[model samples]
Target: MAPKDPLLGTLKVCVLNLQSDGEMVTDTNPHLASCCELLELVLRKGLQQPVISLVHRDYWQCFEQLTHQDPCGRLSALSLAVEQTRVCRKLLSAQGRGRYLLRLALSRKALPQFITHLLHTPRVLEWYSPTTSILRNEEFVEPFMSLLLVLSHMEFKLNMENCSFLDESWLLPVCETYEVVPCREVGMALRYLSGRVFVLNLKPGSQAYVDKFICPW
Candidate 1:
């Protein structure tokens, strides 16, 4: 993060603030909203003018379009990552959709992977100008990505069920905090890879069953 670049400078400050707030960030966390807004700014910066009036410069919209193109299976991979959000029937406006998707990505610690896929898409890459968008500039892009990688290691515990008002407001939802525990301890663990689903059973010492899990009840 360069001290000279305004976005980077602000972002560096926000991340520093996050460190003081601990590793687990919730929607109520002030720094969490700031960071998400900054990320939105990064994606929407110097965007190419759109011919469609309804089409605004939103990170999720761009990512969704990129998904349609499926560059290097990057879009496909992340499509699965966010499929839950995509099927969210509550989100009405693109703004809500974008915010929800962004938050979900952060919670899942998949923001870096999502951005990595977007960068690989040359066609969608042109939507952002190298001069204005950090994701486009060859020099800044690397550092920008590195910053996202840093975020990936942190824990985000956002409330996915609080998306009812997303279509109308930009407010961050109340993030729920839960005790630290392994996914397998919850009785079910889902892992998707290359379009394949792997299910983990909860019983201690139980082996992960591949797409063949059945309720023992």
Candidate 2:
């Protein structure tokens, strides 16, 4: 077919390294650990750069390729890389950096996919800290809310329950603070909790304004 993408090749190598080890990349597996470190560096750099450049070049292509090749395995590696890099924690820690990364990820159509892949996978979500407070942060509210809403839509499309990303404890607080509407396309009825109804819009980008609030009563 076409020449192999270098980035994709690198990702495959990392994936293979992890597979060959047959265990988590621990200190014992120096080679696998090094590969993971390199992968993290590449991902962090890609996140910092412009979406257009990241996608039009090779990062997105590599990601997509790895995803298609081994959806579960590659995603595991990615989730581990993100965790090791602490990229999300760092971004959420700073208003400016969080906003910048959120905007950049959204602009490139990467955030939704990343969030879905990161949170939807059973293995990954098990250990994921669904930090609800991040949703309340001023800088993160819009992007985080939007991505959650998007995830709701994807689940609806798959005939799955809405808000699959959040557990009951996290969902209640978020729904209380923010209006989470389900996607209309699924014909899913509004879920009511204690007389409070939650609705989601079908349109992908049609999330309620971050500052807007509705009385739950």
Candidate 3:
């Protein structure tokens, strides 16, 4: 069920649903192949959404299996997937989902190349327009930010893990500077903006807190 506009977010949700349900989407028929590619891109975008908690679980598992089957090729594909995830997270958080999708479709793998190619793509700059109302609500903000942090840590060029280290006794000042603005932004919505932060423990209490804070829908 495509929306009236059938923008990228809608397409991504559909594709994720299909993947989660184990639908046989592949690159066999030309049109279907294109659809698979589109779905892949959408999944990349969905990685940035706030609603899907296990963003990389299934995809990464499938990718791991693919790599085990063909280590050489699948590794490259994995790298590309991670890069796309980073790009998608950056675009979605800074911009909006529709705009990010349009740019993603145009710029596909614009990371290792020239940023000029990315800038030249349509809808890339459209996100900054004051008139560009968010197609999706801002509830996606937390997930978007959390994914941005994670993806920023795990991208192709930056193969680092996330380490939460709060610059002791400075969170309030930092939040005071960045969190207060004209609009109710994500920075304001995040509850820990005023606290000493550390890598959220995923075992128990901290894990539950992280799940509440960063869990994708």
Scored by TM-score, the top model is 1
Kindly list the per-residue Cα lDDT of model 3 for residues 1-217, writing each as its tens digit. Answer: 5223244455445434434534332222123223334433433433322245645232222222332443345245344544554444323232232222222322343322222222233333222222222213243323333322322232121111111111121011112122222432232122244433433333334334433444322
Candidate number with the higher lDDT (1 or 2):
1
Model 2 steric clash total: 4
lDDT digits (tens) for residues 101-144 of candidate 2:
33334233355565556334444233322332232233443444
Per-residue alpha-carbon lDDT of candidate 1 for residues 105-196, written as tens digits (9 for 90 to 100): 88878888888878877888888877777887777777788788878888888887877676665574443443433444444566776533
TM-score of 2: 0.24
TM-score of each: 0.71, 0.24, 0.20
What Cα-based lDDT does every candidate model obtain? 0.72, 0.36, 0.31
Candidate 1, overall lDDT?
0.72
Off by over 4 Å in 3: 1-41, 44-57, 71-217
Q: Name the weakest run of 10 consecutive residues (lDDT summed) in model 2.
A: 154-163
Candidate structures ordered by TM-score, highest first: 1, 2, 3
Best by lDDT: 1
Error (Å) of candidate 2 at residue 140 is: 28
TM-score, predicted candidate 3 vs. hidden true structure: 0.20
